[model samples]
Target chain A: MENVRVIARMDIKGPNLVKGIHLEGLRVLGKPEDFARYYYENGADELFYQDVVASLYERNSLHDIVSRTAKDSFIPLTVGGGIRSIDDIREVLRAGADKVCINTAAIRNPEFIRDAANKFGSSTIVVAIEAIRQPDGKYMAFVDNGREHTGVEVISWARRVEELGAGEIVITSVDREGTGKGYDIALTRSIARAVGVPVIAHGGPGKKEHFTDVLLEGKADAIAVASMIHYDLIAQQQSDMENRSEGNVSFLKSGRSSFGEIAPAGLIAIKQYLKESNIPCRN
Target chain B: MSGKKIAIIDYKLGNLFSVRQACVYLGYDAVVTSEKDEVMKADFAILPGVGAFGDAMNNLEKLDLISPIKDYIRAGRPFMGVCLGLQLLFTESDEFGSHKGLNLIEGTVKKFPPKKTNDEVLKVPQIEWNNIWERADRRWESTPLGSCRSGDYMYFVHSFFVQPQSPDVVLSVTTYGETTYCSSVLQGNLFACQFHPEKSGHHGVGIYKNWLTNYSNNK
Candidate 1:
């Protein structure tokens, strides 16, 4: 088995970093660049920047953020959201992103994945599947940050993306996202087993044990974490970040930080716990 | 203070920013270009790419960079290739279909196996950070990878790997799933790796610095 990659996922809305439950009700965190540099220095294996409202705005404002983050952070950077055409992919790559993830565009026209993969190697293209569990226990894919339904099944979509030449897949469970209970193991394992490419499990990570569970039981090659690490960073310097002049800082000001009733742990501590459990991960 | 000219080859198939930024971070002025003259004049020329093998060859040929690159290497200038750039120097690749390469190195690029020997399904395009161990005589003290110790993890994102015909050229080997293949090679003034050193962090930068510090003035 390969070492599980722990990626710090930052959801961006305009210039401020935001977080929400089920990918809705956005709450401003802080400058993503600050959190990105912190994560890179602290031991984030990779950085994932997703423009949450890019599809709604019809433009991606992550190019500046991506370039600034890439300047100091030398790790792999992946940017997602609002990537609709080849030019959009090229612009992000030129802005210092190593990979571009397509969600809405990929769901709208599946062939776009093939074209993007063909133009920019499969390794450069990542198909992000936003999935929500249906009432009948079937996982259905969603688009636009889980704001719209695609009526596409998650497992079959994973297989199709891999077949279309996607080098990697990021299957984010909308229902589990931001809830911090744990990952949807069934969703992760199903997609992981459905595709030969590496699968990155996103959302629903609250504590250190949750990461262990997702990697061991979910069979995810990598895990994309947000609130868990984000809240931890904010908690460490709550005093310093209180006066920041960007985004809505009400969540930070409240000083009541918890991911689904459990306090979040720092990334370093999480990696230490993973190592003690015999799970391979880069320090 | 090395003052060595660095040219990152731009075949229009991959991101040249990270490679150039890595070079700039090392205090060397790097130029990303397709002009043959710029490439030939550079003290250190780098071929960095991330795309299919067939498309890369087409772009290189379209830009008329084939002869100059071959000449640059023939002149014994210090050269480095990353990811698809490393694969492009081989004889041919099995990606997409049969496609000829620069043939600068006697090798063929092949895809990773779909399944391991233990009947476990293997993931293509290993995208995780995996460690590399010294293979050829355990001699890394003089190569660009000298700064990195054995078992140092580097960022890898590719499905196909190169198989050099000459075993002596193999500098390092990495095992993914059940298969172990050549991860990097060093021959004369040329060094290439399947992993992206620019994205590999500080030790990776140390690689470019070592190559520049040691081989830059040798030419």
Candidate 2:
């Protein structure tokens, strides 16, 4: 078994870091670089920056943000959003991302995944699958942050992406995203079982147990968190506002944690819980 | 970490930025360049990249860095290789149909078997933080891994691993799904690893610092 990775995922919308429930109703958080620096300092295994509104605009604006974050953070940074062609991927990578995750372009042309894997290495390519569980007991893939539904089955898509040369797959549940309900175990397990590549469970994770549950029960190799960790940062930012020197952290002072019941915990606390639960994690 | 002309060889592959960042963080002024003269003139050189072996070899050849890199190592100055850079030092690779490498180390880079001994399908590219343990005969006190504990975890993302012809040169090994392979090697001034020291967090950065310090002391 692989050591479980705790990745801090930041959903970016233009200049501010945003979050939403079920991938809708965007709410501003703060500057992504600020959160990125905090996460790296707190022991995040990896960092993911997703441009929430990039696909609609056909241009990724996270280049400046990614470059700024890369200047300080030493961990692997994955940038995803509006990536259409080889040039787009190259530009994002040259800016500082170690890996580029694609969804909209990959769904439009599946061969783009293959082309990317061949041009770069398979390890540099990650395919993000946005899935919504249907009433028929099936999961359907979605694009553009679950706004557009592609009729493609999530399980088959996961297998195809792996076969197409995706080194890793991040399966985000559109229904559970930002809801704090926990990860879709059935959805993540099915995808993890269907593919030979490492699968990262994303979307809902309200508590530390949710992480362990996804890794053990869902069979996920890693877990990507946005609301869970972001809320923790918000709490920290609020208490330390007096010492702050730069950036508008008023958004973080909102004291808004949509993740109900379970309190927000830092990366170290989460890793400590995983370690106590006998799940290997890099602290 | 002071005034050491560290050349981070750039062949249009991998994340040279993070490697340079890690070096700079350690207070060493490193340059990312493809020029042979710059690389040769550097006190220490690091070959770091992530991509196909064939393409990397082609790129190195195109940029005329193959000889300079080999000459730098031959001159006995400190040298390091990361990920594909480590693979490139081997004799050849089975990735994308058997491509010849720099042949500095006598080894063949081969992919992990599809199935483990338990008959379970093993995931390729093993993208995770796996623990690396020093060999029983090897003492890490003198190597770049001097600061690393025996079971310290390191970031890894690769499908293929190196099988050095001489086991004595193997410094560490990591087991993934029952497939144990050489993870790092130390042969005189040449040290390389399959894991990325730059992206491996604090412990990873510590390895670079140790390597630089070791080079400085020896000089």
Superposed by TM-score, candidate 1 places the C-alpha of residue A112 at a distance from the truth, in angstroms, of 1.0
How big is the positional error of residue A52 in model 2, measured in Å on the Cα after superposition? 0.5
Error of 1 at A90 (Å): 1.3
**What TM-score should be assigned to candidate 2?**
0.94
Q: Could you tell me which 10 consecutive residues in candidate 1 chain B have the lowest summed lDDT?
A: B210-219
Q: iRMS values in order, in angstroms?
A: 1.0, 1.4
lDDT of 2 by residue, A121-186 (tens): 889999999998889999999999999989999998998998899989999999999888899999
Cα RMSD to the true fold for all candidates: 2.7, 2.6
List candidate 2 segments past 4 Å from native: A239-262
Task: List where candidate 1 sits over 4 angstroms from the true fold.
Answer: A239-253, A257-260, B217-219
CA lDDT scores, all candidates in order: 0.89, 0.90
Worst 10 residues of 2 chain B by lDDT: B116-125
Per-candidate TM-score against the hidden true structure: 0.95, 0.94
